[model samples]
Each structure stands twice: as structure tokens, then as C-alpha cells.
Target: MKQKISLITTGGTIASKETKNGMLSSGALSGDELAALCKLPDDIEIRIVDFMKVPSMHMNFHRMLALRDAINKELEDPDVTGVVVTHGTDSLEETAYFLDIVTEDKRPIVVTGSQRSPQEVGTDVYSNLRNSIYAAANPLLENGGVVVVFNERIYSAKYVKKVHASNLQGFESFGYGYLGIIDNDVVSIYQKPLHREFFSVQNEIPRVDIIKCHTGADGLFIDASVAVGAKGIILEGVGRGQVTPQMVSSIQKALDSGTNIVITTSAEEGKVHPAYDYEGSAFDLKERGVILGADYDSKKARIKLAVLLACKNKIKSSDFKY
Candidate 1:
């Protein structure tokens, strides 16, 4: 039986081209153009849908909701075995995480994009697009949640990180490593994410921001964020999620003011532990009622916070399942 895959194009470097003025212009290619860039098996059917033409940096909450709607609509069709979304790398992780948290269906939703533009030499678009299709088509990927395939590495949507500037293998999932990889036309599974659930957006755009703590960094940013009425804040603390004295006081104040504060480690991998020497900054902040962000990076943490804030009234800490 032939497997049908819907290739949803949200413009990124993969679909961008250099204009006469040498500026990178996006959405220059149609779905048919992208379909022709890859080689596929005869038993696999491909359909393309252009969801947006903006770069990943331009991606926001509203666009994410629209993409979710598109995927949900396609999932309704029995023939659509899987979905592939080509998005810009800048915000690929954010979009992937959003989909993983919101969408309930297990049908493989693989998001991928090229590090190098299609016009550049040794572009990775063809292979990434090909492997994403394979990953999406494989039945093993079912119920695995959102998966991102780029530069021969497959990452769990919730754990993946874009660490490098312009490298082909830029996407990585720090301590957890990759969930699996696609090799020899085979999609193999190594590990599964510990948590998974479906969250509802409900059209509310919640404001969540991240505050990175460094030496001599005052609480000005934190105050500004709160002043602008941020519902949630993710504090990217030092190693093992430690903040300075000043920042700690700011976080404590934020929490006291009824704002949700999630503390996450700036380390590439590992979850935040409140047990490590709480006598100083760590202990003070923990006492102030800040929630630990676990292993989520600042970017993913922001998305998780935003999604949670959107469902704030309808969800509680225990019911805050994601």
C-alpha cells in the first residue's frame, strides 16, 4: 500500500533564493518545486501545502496556531499517514515543541529545514527533505510524538536544540541525545521522551519571557518584563540553575507578585536540581516558590510556559499535564 505524506512548507532557508539585488527572498518556490528536489519511493505519495513564506525568526504564536490547524486538518484524512513541515532553523525547535505539546495524534509529524540555503553549495535540503519523508512514513514513528530530522540526526521535539551558527549538524538534544536516526533508508528508535501529552491553545496568546542571569546583571530586565505584564518567566540561570543574589531577589519578587517563574539550567543538558547547595542563591530562590523547568532549554521553556499560561485558568500544577 502506498503511504501518503503531506509536505507543509513554512518558508525557511530551504525554500529561499537569492534575488537580483542579492537579498534572500523567500517563498520563491512552490510545493511542486520542493517535491521535485527530492527522490522518493514509488509506494510513497507526497502532497505539498504552503502554510507561510516568512523566515523562522518571524514565527510567532499566531502562526504556530495556524500551523497546528493545518496539521489537524490533514490528520483527519485516513490516507495521510504522516506530515513533514519545512521551517526555518531559527525557530524550528520552538515550532516543533509547540506541535508536540498540542497535537494528540501519534501520526509522525516530522519538522525539518536546511542549514544552508538551496542556492548554496552542498545544500542539505534534498537529503533532509528525503529523510524527513522516510521518518514520517515509517509506522515506528507513530505515537513517538514530534520528531525533527536534520543533518542525519533525529531529535525528540521536546529535547532538540540548535546549538551551532551555520553547521549542517546544528540541531542537537544535549544530555538526552537523539531519539533516533535515519540510516540506510531505515528509521531506528533509540530512546523515548519521558513525558508526552496534548495541550490546548484556545486562542489565548500568553506572554512568556526568558531572563538570562550573568555577572553584575541587574534585575532591570526582569522588572521590565513584569512591568509589561508577562504572565510567565523562565530564568536561565548559571550552572545547575543558580542565579546571583540580585537576580534571586528579582525572581522572588516576581513569584510573590503572582507571576509564574520557571528555573532552568543554562547547561546544555540535565534538569534543574534544587538540592545542590541551597544555602546561597539556589536555596533562596527555591524558597520563593519558583518552579523548576527540568531539562527544557530557555527557548523550549518559553514555549512550554506560553502554552501553559494560555491554559492557566483551565489547568493547575497537577492538571498542568504536558
Candidate 2:
């Protein structure tokens, strides 16, 4: 029997087309158009779903939820083996991670995007999408949760990040590396996440913001976020998660106002640890009810926090220990 896979397209560079002005129009091509350009596997039956046509930056929580619903709808089919989502590289990691947390299905949900437009020379649009479909249908990835397939590598959504601006090798998982790779149309698996998490979120995703810390940074942004009624804030701190002393007051005030704040390190690798006693150190922040994000990039932390809040989960320090 031929393996059946659902190809859900949300647009990205892979679906972009060159405009008259010599600039690329993101998501200019439809799902069927993009799929038609690729020499997809003949052994697999592909079902194309044109969900949306927009740039990655245009993606928001509401749309993400809608995409999740659409994917889940496809999964309801018993013959469908898995799913492959073509997205823009800009926000692909966040969307992938969001699906990873909310999608409870054991079948793989593979997200992929190309850095170059499909019309460009040396574009990766064909290979990435093709590899993703194979990876999605692979039985070894059945319980591995959502994965990002790009440039032949399969990365866990939890750890993957876009590392380069325009390189074909745009996505990377940093310290953790990739789960496996697809070579010559063959899907190979070397590892899988030991644990998976799913949150059943029925409500709208709450407002979540990410604030980057720098030298002499103050609490103004934090206060503003709180004033705007943000449900969660991710603090991208430096070194072992240390913010400027001036920012601590605003962070504390936000906490007082019931804003869930997670402190994540900006470093490529390493967990946020309470290592110092300074006013804005991770230790001090944790003492004041801040959650330490365990090696999660700020964007991923923001996605998780928003999902957790949407699920009405009580924010806790231990919540980030995935």
C-alpha cells in the first residue's frame, strides 16, 4: 500500500515568486503550484492543502491555532501516515514548537521552509519539501513529536533555530544538533526526543512578549508590557541569565501584577541557572518568582509560555524544565 501524507502549505520562500520589481513576493505561489514544481515521490500519495499564503512574520497565534486545527483535521483520516508543513523560515521554528506542544498525535508532524525563493538559482525548495514528506511518513518518527526538516536534516522543533540568513543550511539545533537526515530520498533516524509534551488549549492564545536585555537596559519595556496586559514575558538575558539592575524593578512589578516571566539565556547553548546574587541575576530573579527557561531560545520560550497560559496552566518555576 502506498503511504499517504498530507502536505499543508502556509507559504514561505518555498512558495515565493519573483515580482516585476525584482523583489520576491512571499507566498506568491499556491500550495498546488509549489508542489507541482517538485518531483515528489511516486510511491507516496500526497494530499495538498492550501491553508494560507503569507510571510512567516505575518503568522500569529490565531493563525497558528487555525493551522493546528487544519493539520489535526487531516490526521483524522486513518490512511494518512503523517503531515508535512511548508512554512516561511522566518517564523517556522516558533510555529513548529507550538505544534509540538499542542499536537498529541504520535504520527510525525514535519515542518520545513526554504531560505531562497523557489525561482532563485540553487534554491532548496524541491529537496526540503521532498525530504520532509519522506521524514513525515517514516515510521521511526511516529512518536517523535513535531520535527523541522531542512537541507536534508531533521531537527526537533524544541531545539531547532534558523542559524543563517540566506544559506541553504539555514536551520540548526545548536548544541543538540539534528535528529537525523534524509539522503538520496531515504529517511534515516539517529535519535528522538525522550519525552513529549502536549497541552490541550481551547482558548485563544494570550499575549506574550519577549524582551532582550543589554547593558544599561532599564525596565521601561517590561512596565509597558505589563501595562498592555501581557500574560507572559520572556527575558532574553546575557550569560547565566543576568539582566541589568535597572530592569529588575520593572520585572518585579510585572510579577506583582501577575505577569509570568521566564528568564532564558541568549547563549546558543546552556541552561539558565541561578548562579549569582546580584540584583538582576538569575538567582535574584528566581528568588522573586521568575521561571528559569532551560536552554530554550527566547522565541521558543515565548511560544511555550503563551500555550501554557492559553491552557490555563498556573505559571510555575518548574514549568520550564522540559
RMSD of each: 2.0, 0.8
Model 2, 1-322: lDDT tens digits are: 9999999999888999998999999998999999889999999999999999999999999899999999999999989999999999999999999999998999989999999988888999999999999998899999999999999999999999988999998988889989999999898999999989999998888899999999999999999999998999999999999999999889999988889999999999899998899899999999999999989999999999999998885887767878
How does residue 206 of candidate 2 score in lDDT? Answer: 89
Q: Estimate the overall C-alpha local distance difference test score of candidate 1.
A: 0.82
Which structure among the candidates has the greatest TM-score?
A: 2
**Worst-scoring 10-residue span by lDDT in model 2:** 312-321
Q: Positional deviation of 261 in candidate 2, in angstroms?
A: 0.8
* Lowest summed lDDT window (length 10), candidate 1: 313-322
Misplaced by over 4 Å in model 1 are 276-280, 314-322
Cα deviation at 132, candidate 2, in Å, is 0.7
What is the lDDT, from 0 to 100, of the residue 10 in candidate 2? 95
Candidate 1, residues 1-322, lDDT tens digits: the string is 7899999999888888888998877656666777776675556888888778888899999999999999999999989999999999989999999999999998999999988877789999888988999899988888889999998778989888888889998888777788788886788888776667777878587898998988878789988899999988888987777887767667767777888887777888666766666632545566677776667788888888788778764323343233
